[model samples]
Target chain A: MSVENSDLLKTPLYSLHESLGGKMVPFAGYLMPVQYPLGVMGEHNHTREKAGLFDVSHMGQVVISGENADQWLETLVPGNIIDLKQNRIRYTMFTDDNGGILDDLMITRRENDIFMVVNAGCKAEDIAHMRATMPDHLELTELNDRALVALQGPLAAEVLARFTSGADEMDFMSYGEVEICGAKCFISRCGYTGEDGHEISILAANAEEVCNALLGEPEVEAIGLGARDSLRLEAGLCLYGHDITTKTSPIEGALQWSIGKRRREQGGFPGADKILGQLASGDIARKRVGILPAGRAPAREGTEILDAGDNVIGVITSGGFGPTFGAPIAMGYVDLKYSAAETPIFLQVRKKKLEAKVANMPFVAQNYYRKPK
Target chain B: MTTYYSEDHEWINVESGVGTVGITDYAQNALGDIVFVEVPEVGDELAKGDEVAVVESVKAASEIYSPVTGEITAVNEDLEDNASLVNSSAGGDGWFFKISISDDSELEGLMDADGYKTFTAGLE
Candidate 1:
């Protein structure tokens, strides 16, 4: 379906994307590129072997500062914030009073302030949640003028090192402020694609320049949201609205690893009573599982999953062809008994019941760079 | 043999009361890198505009409709192992099925080569 261009918002790199042959589509209230001329398959493969740049300027970037910023922030999120050393990033979710996920985000702690990267669709609510909850002395500032772009893949470090100092030396989930193409940029050694990469946040005016410089590199190609979604799917990462929502707590999403021990025990964050209780009992009703279709038909989202006896047990949340795996893969929530790897499940796709099995995720291996302990 | 095109981007090349069906290049281009295709079973009856087959690309799934009323005579087995054939040769080796034409008059409703070209041009 075509939308009138005038009704949608455009990023600062809209002109550059158009010049590069990007197929623009509506995503999260913005006209974003879904794929370039290289197409989704080529872009997914290139990002694994080389580097692909993506315009993620639609995500909301915010900074929370003032006295006890870390302590104050801890009250709203499940991940331990006070203990996170400067320049380290932690994946956390803001939960409601009932332990339901409000939104999932990445919080990067600086020397005195904390920077957050939130999902584009949930940003407005996330920002409002912080503004409404944080202590009176704290300051919540939205960096609306910044454009976020991700340089992802095995060759990402090699491509980024040329433009920014100390990029090659950064560890996974580490953050730093550096200059890229003469623009002051916030660089994070992190990405949604399972490959080793960096996310660069730049000023609106300098987004085109930085992106142009990266695309000039022989190893770097412009990747659109199509590859981004498939890459992250194969990487076993959850998309906020699809895989997790306010109705889904972290434990049910198999994201319990993101919640730290201190928070799990102390119970100060929102919905801590329920989240901590779930942690203690380990009785989650349904859990997310990786699924592989036995046949060639792709079992996409909203397809009902049935058990051995043809009784409906779950539904697919994210489903599609895993371009890298060369097979169709999906993630969905299933009853506790059917969530185990290798458990047989049937996907009711259209009129036929296609055979599928629960399997281990990260259909592609993760390649994040970490410091050897 | 006369080839007719449907608005859904399916082309049926009819010969000797049998029609070979496949998606057009424009359909494949819009779909992008087909990875899976579900072809109708041989001997199944189809009506004009019925959803006869499915072509799944890396990006999304598209339905290939029956351009004319007919009975499925044979299906393409190559698509089971190499769905990319739909992307490489959408109109030739990538054909989805063969149908025994039940109504020659139904073919009159489809567009010829020149007409199909004009029809697609107006979309852009």
Candidate 2:
């Protein structure tokens, strides 16, 4: 995130955010709203119970084209991009040579090419990495003139179906280019929060009008990054710089499921040797596990995790109060020996050791809209 | 009862040398929704400027410092069940703890209502 203080950039919805009484703060070089008058807790619960709209224009959107784009993408990421069905999305990561993740992204196989969304903070670096490594036959076009908005929750499809036809019929991880309120947009039925939702990419010129139309629906409310973080945390989704970083491998981050089975056997992609070896032998020394604190005190990032005997075992990477759970929850890397679902761990919070247990994640069950076969 | 304010946004209402303490409305509004609060235990001795409590909002955690030299005599237990009291009524029902002033002279260094208002305005 660029906090240079020189001059924070504003999104297309800047005036709309201010009009809604959004508390703005600097994030990823853009002045973004961290919460509205509903506050973080209210917005968070509303997203779980009803629907919430988020302006995610800060994320990088790029289109990869030319012949064999999917094959070239497979070399950069461990995911099986070549086999991706048209209009389907895959969660994958760009890895460094040593198996560390450069950035995790969403890859959607469009009709004639692939569209990818990367973290805003790392977008510049990601683009540079692709330009330097990819062959001349591949084309990477940055969609800087577009805005991305996520409409999330159980009521999302119902609310969105009012404006666009065939939206409710789209299954999870599926996408299509459709016209929303007279503006053409690429809509994907996916989001960071573990809820059935859609992310709409529209031209920056039409962002404000499109978002206003969405908010006009009674079920939709404007949500800020504060609620977004807590929502993803409860869903056990990893935040880029915090939960998973260059120092940690995918196996250690517990993202093995993201690696395609064919790629695992073929031994392609960066850091394949280290990642595949660990996957085959199950020799990962540490794993990311969810920790449920016995008390209300939130064990924030950098809080030390200790054993019963007061020996330091790990450290909390992300921790906060889960409003839905009404308790303090955390996720951290713990030694594989103590990473089981029910294993008890201790957290050193403000000079006192508090007892916590390793719990299964999504601490809340995911509500993805999987189509019935 | 005279209410004195600290630079850190804590307000203490003093009566008969026993002071009731809590954060001000401005502090609560800035912190958004309050989730948890950790107050000093009864009978804990504290000096001025000591970190005596913690206020954890949804996004971040902040420390509440003691404004004057005092010993904690009683703590409001209602906050354990309803932490939103800090958000609803920051200076009244949200009072964190009551303390017996060890040295009443230290109160002179704190700001009165008008003075604190000017101090907070200058901060903006």
Candidate 3:
């Protein structure tokens, strides 16, 4: 989708967002709400304490149905898609021939088909790539008529359960098709935020009605892309374009966990040699590390990182003031020697060298709902 | 005391030889939540239109330019702990710094209250 033109596309909830006083900005060919009148900080805090609803209609949803769907998908990604149980979701990514990331995505296995959700900005290219690579028998169908919404935070399950049966009972990374307000919807027990929440896939025509009903809940507020960025950053989640790119490999991006052990041994996926080599020897030159600036100033993206001797060692990829931490939090790539947590580092912010350290990530603890042992 | 505004949405109130400077209420509202305010040093000398301070919001960082050739006399230290002052009281207690005007004639280039109101309205 070419976005060079002055005009921007709007989602089904565009007018509703405007009426709610959302600050709309151009994002990935769509005019998305960056924040509401409550502001980014308030919206972020509200999502952490209560529930925040987000319109994710721009995200590309596709269904892959065939006898060899799982086997076909494993050829492109390192994740163990073949073993993904029914209704279970696995976070994974597509890769180029050189072990570089194409785009990160979520793959959910269903009873008869596999549901895939890719980033909105990469949807066009992703569809083209799949069409070119997949076998003729596998059908890749884009669910363009559907709109996606996410209800996230600690109170998300409680609010979602009011509309759908058996929603609160689903464990983390689970999905199912159910009825919501008389509309047949696909609801998943997962979200971008580190909280227990649901991502509901509904028809575009019924999106506004369902969104309004969800917002009518006493504990829910409309969150925008602004809070979504901060919330994910605090949870130590990677943003595709910012943290991982075509030049960075998965091992170097601190996403080694996503590569299944079976795939690592089989060596059939794209760029498996280079990826598995890095995992075995641990010889990568640089690794992604979380950095916390000591003072109040936030060292944003592209800020040069320095070692103890003030020599430049790396650069910040994603950095911002974490509202929940009440201090500036950042993440960047550093020399593998200095990637260890608590390693003292400095950031060159303008003329000043700000004191910082390589800190452990998930600056906030993950609160996913897992079944107790 | 006479108040003036710059095209960049900065406001200055001149009293005697001292000029108190802060961003306009419109700027604060547009910036959303203010996370950090980099105040100019008290002894630093600045030229008119020079970038002296910085205001960082949750989404971006913006520079504040000096409205007149001046020497920074004082900065609102309260912002060190409470940067949201720019959001709550932009024109009053949220003042960024006080400067001792080096060239009083430089103030002539700024817009008055009525002119600033019209300028901001044109922007919308």
TM-scores for all predictions: 0.98, 0.97, 0.97
Every candidate's chain B TM-score: 0.98, 0.97, 0.98
**True lDDT of residue A152, candidate 3:** 96
Question: What residue pairs clash in candidate 3, if any at all?
Answer: none
Regions more than 4 Å wrong, model 2: A1-6, B121-124
User: lDDT tens string, model 1, B9-106?
Assistant: 99999999999999999989989989999999998998999999988888788888899888999999999999999899988999999999998999
Candidate whose TM-score is highest:
1
Identify the superior model by DockQ, candidate 1 or candidate 3. Answer: 1
In terms of lDDT, the poorest run of 10 residues in model 2 chain A is: A1-10
Tens-place lDDT digits, model 3, residues A63-89? 999998999999988899999999999
Backbone clashes under 3 angstroms, per model: 0, 0, 0
- Compared with the true structure, all predictions reach lDDT values of 0.92, 0.93, 0.92
Q: How many backbone clashes can be found in candidate 3? A: 0
- lDDT digits (tens) for residues B1-124 of candidate 2: 9999999999999999999999999899989899999889999999999999999998899999999888999999999888899999998999999999989998999999999999989977
Q: What is the lDDT of residue A258 in candidate 2?
A: 93
Docking class for model 3 is medium
Instruction: Tell me how far the alpha carbon of residue A129 in candidate 2 is from the true structure, in angstroms, after superposition.
Output: 1.2
Per-candidate alpha-carbon RMSD to the true structure: 1.1, 1.5, 1.6
Among all windows of 10 consecutive residues in model 1 chain B, the one with the lowest summed lDDT is: B55-64
